[model samples]
Target: MTATQDSVSSLQTSVPPALSLGVVALSVADLGRSLDYYRQVIGLEVLEQDTHRVVLGAGGEPLLDLHGQPGAATSVAAHTGLYHLAILLPGRADLGRFAAHLIREQLPVQGASDHHVSEAIYLEDPDGHGIEVYADRSPESWAWQGGQVKMDTRAADIGSIVASAGQDTAWRGVPAGTVMGHVHLKVADLAASRAFYEELLGLDVVADFSAHGALFVSQGGYHHHFGLNVWQSRGGQPAQVGEARLLSASVFLPEAELAALRARLLEAGHPLPATGDTFTVTDPSGNLLRFGRKV
Candidate 1:
């Protein structure tokens, strides 16, 4: 709650142990096509695969384990599923290389914008799930005021951003230790999303703008890691099982703090829908947020 040189990082009074992030999975409509796109265009190395799924990694660590199935490809305008899976590049030259790669592979970006704290290239995956290719500006450079995280989006000069992606090399896949930086959501309602992620889940509200139908928050200030947008889904519900399902998600926390949060949420009448070494609560929007000891 206090800020020194590093203000955006939310130092919780009773933080649970640090269970840093784990891998994220996407259930794409066509496993082969999705895998091909990620592996070839995005430059991720495939770890393992069979008839049903494929696991992938960048720098040798798994980032996503994709489940392939035959399902209806819904309209991006109406799908109540993933907002985007953000892939954090090590630097900007890598981002440029990625931009080059996107251009090479004929990958179409929905839009690319610079959010003062970072620059991002946005695209939709094979099954309508959103994807963001981005890299952050240093933490020391992030700005804050009035109990809100400040962010602005403008045209990121494609040439400048690509030049920064990697000073020497092109950003094909993330460097080793790449993680699911953060998961953004396109929920139906902002207030409900805020209540569940902030109030019920106890995440500090880093930023909330009523006009934008958007919010930006993170445990540590890493430039608005998790994003929520409701432009199309003004009041949509979570997607059903047949079309798609969110296999799982996580909240990296210190192991020391799990029991306390679990007890706190239980006392608040929002006990875990499922619990183990970790506790999980489904948001009003049906996305699962996992809290557990930091791995």
Candidate 2:
């Protein structure tokens, strides 16, 4: 059974309810190369670009911003950073189109699988950040029991998933309520992970399974916003360069609330990084984090 629990008395939703998360930025070894891979190869439009960063989008808004930081190195087993940035697609058809595109372009896929709850396509961004591009199977269809969300990893009918995307003449972006959704991480200790993301981050727990080596939590009512798994770090300490380095994770808050959080972080000694008008910060595990008004 899940161990994490939602501590919020009630979820405070903002006006219009900010879409899950608009953009997740990552620090990469080669900004130019990654930009080319995402834009030219991945086919995402370039919304904005600068010497230090580049934002790419599927349609209306930017989904990912790639930042070039020379010294940002990551080791595969690093338990201190981002787990994965999930991109919720418009539908199965969109997934189809992307699959076809990957086949046509010779794009490399790390792995693809059906998580019972959702079908996911995964790949690593140039800087070693985990990226999951997926489509949901309608909320009403999701299976759950005993307050535990049932998720499974099984073979995906790629042919069927791809067929959906190939249906429409053009790709419709991610669904209306889609988001960066949940971020999963490898934490040193279950208790400490709970202390920060739940008590401190203030997100409600949706699932907590100490037995399954995972924990899931969310804000408002849209599944989990973050997940923590101790399978890799069941008894390890916070070390450096574990294969994966969570470049940065984002949380969207109202503009005013974001300002408040900035002050809160400073007061807590987790100073936000100032870049032009953006203020970013690093979490206890050295993972970079960004916050801004919900977009």
Candidate 3:
């Protein structure tokens, strides 16, 4: 069972409410090429663009911001950086359409899995940045055991899902209700990562894959909002600024939740680096997470 099904009452008391993920920023080598890939392959509209940077999203909302650098190199090894940026679709029909589009275009799809809580399709961008397009299952259907959400990676029945599309609705673009669901990152150490995300930041450990060198945590227990893994980046350095790597990710919380987080950080001896309406913190793996309220 997932946390949403089993721990609603307890989560309401222990975790902060109204937490949501936001825009993920990246550094890219070629702005034009990355823009074309995101627009054509991923079906995202360019919300804003310039010579060096572009913000791409659906329905006028910004989800990904790509900043271009002339000599940037793409490297996954020797760096603790992004594992994947997950884009959550509004419904299964949307995922079906996307799956059909990928087949029609003969695009390279890496993998697809049923995660109990969500069904996800995995692929990569031109720069080899990982991407996951997924649709969550109903909260009531999710199961939980003990205090952890139950999640498993099984082969997705792509054929059946495509057939469910009904052949009426076509793939247009990312739907209006689409959102930046969660981000999975490769980190240096699981112990340190847990200290920052779970202990100091007060997120609930919804899934523990520590046996596989991974951990998934969330607030309010809908499943994981952030996934930390040490698969490829164990004991690696932080990603260089000029590389095509994850730059930052944002999380939205209410004012009271933010204040509570601040107090917790102070109590845990973590610094609060202020930036306008947001308070930014660097995780143990050096990934930047900015926490703020919705404006």
Candidate 4:
């Protein structure tokens, strides 16, 4: 059954309204190359680094963890894995500065879209892992109809966004408050994914784009925290180990909410081995999601 916001509220269990995304982990082919791309192009600062692993973020908060596996195969379109890791800038001005920086860098942007709720710019990392840097419109500006947010793809007003940068046009790095907003994944089946994320994980379906083979879910009344689509990955296989792809995405929840989710998973027959403060689960489509208590 397709889950709607009303139906989600009626569920016996639901993800805490305060739930939020945390750092996303990825496997990259070349540590050095990926680091350069993320730092120079994506504007993330290196927080910690070692030979095979690196942690990066903005404003001292961890946002991404890259694990290097030398000679790893690059991700393929047929693999059911990351579609994009979205970075949420704190404000539209930040996005404007970023947009101007990309222009100055002459980086090739794949696409730019105004989604009504937000404006997004899309690109790829050194390993072809997709990336989206965006700023959301104010919550009050968002439109809701029939328990679903009204969103569409339209050309973004780059000129207006650049103007929003105002006098502080210099591109320093992503400022404080930047975060890993959401993670979009390519899955083999939309229904199975919905069942896993909505039913088992308890995230509410905020939007259903079944006609486009996509679904979006979130906690609270936010537009979406996770986007699942089969646009190119229908009937696809999971990424093989040692391939450059998403390793996992983390979410933070209140302690009680985390415990409730754990119990629900256990009751539903999803194996969740005991972990200290955090636990990881593989969704039906093989996506790894880690849950931890929100501090």
Best by lDDT: 4
* Inter-residue clash pairs, candidate 3: 1-143, 1-144, 2-143, 2-144
Candidate 3: lDDT over CA atoms?
0.86
* lDDT leaderboard ranking: 4, 3, 1, 2
- What would the per-residue lDDT of candidate 3 be over residues 163-208, giving only the tens digit for each residue? 8688744778788888999999989999999988887787888889
- Which wins on lDDT, candidate 1 or candidate 2? 1
Local error of candidate 2 at 221, Å?
2.8
Better of 1 and 4 by lDDT: 4
Cα distance off (Å), candidate 3, residue 264: 2.7
Worst 10 residues of 2 by lDDT: 1-10
TM-score of 2: 0.76
Give the true-structure RMSD of model 3: 2.1
- The count of residue-pair clashes in candidate 4 stands at 0
Each candidate's lDDT (Cα)? Answer: 0.69, 0.65, 0.86, 0.89
Model 4 alpha-carbon drift over 4 Å, by segment: 1-13
Compared with the true structure, what per-residue lDDT tens digits does model 4 show for residues 1-295?
Answer: 2344454345333777778899999999899999999999989999999999999999999999999988888898888999999999999999999999999889988999999999999999878899999999987777676667778999999999999999887889888999889999999999999989988788877889988999998878788999999998999999989789899999999999899889898898878876566899888778899899999
Q: Count the backbone clashes (under 3 Å) in each candidate.
A: 26, 20, 4, 0
lDDT of 1 by residue, 1-295 (tens): 3463445433452332243556676677888888887877667898888999998878777778788768745434554556787878776666778787777667788999988777889987677777787877776666776446667889888888656645554444656655677788777778887776666555656667758778876554444556767877777767765564455566666545676677778887885655577677777666676665665
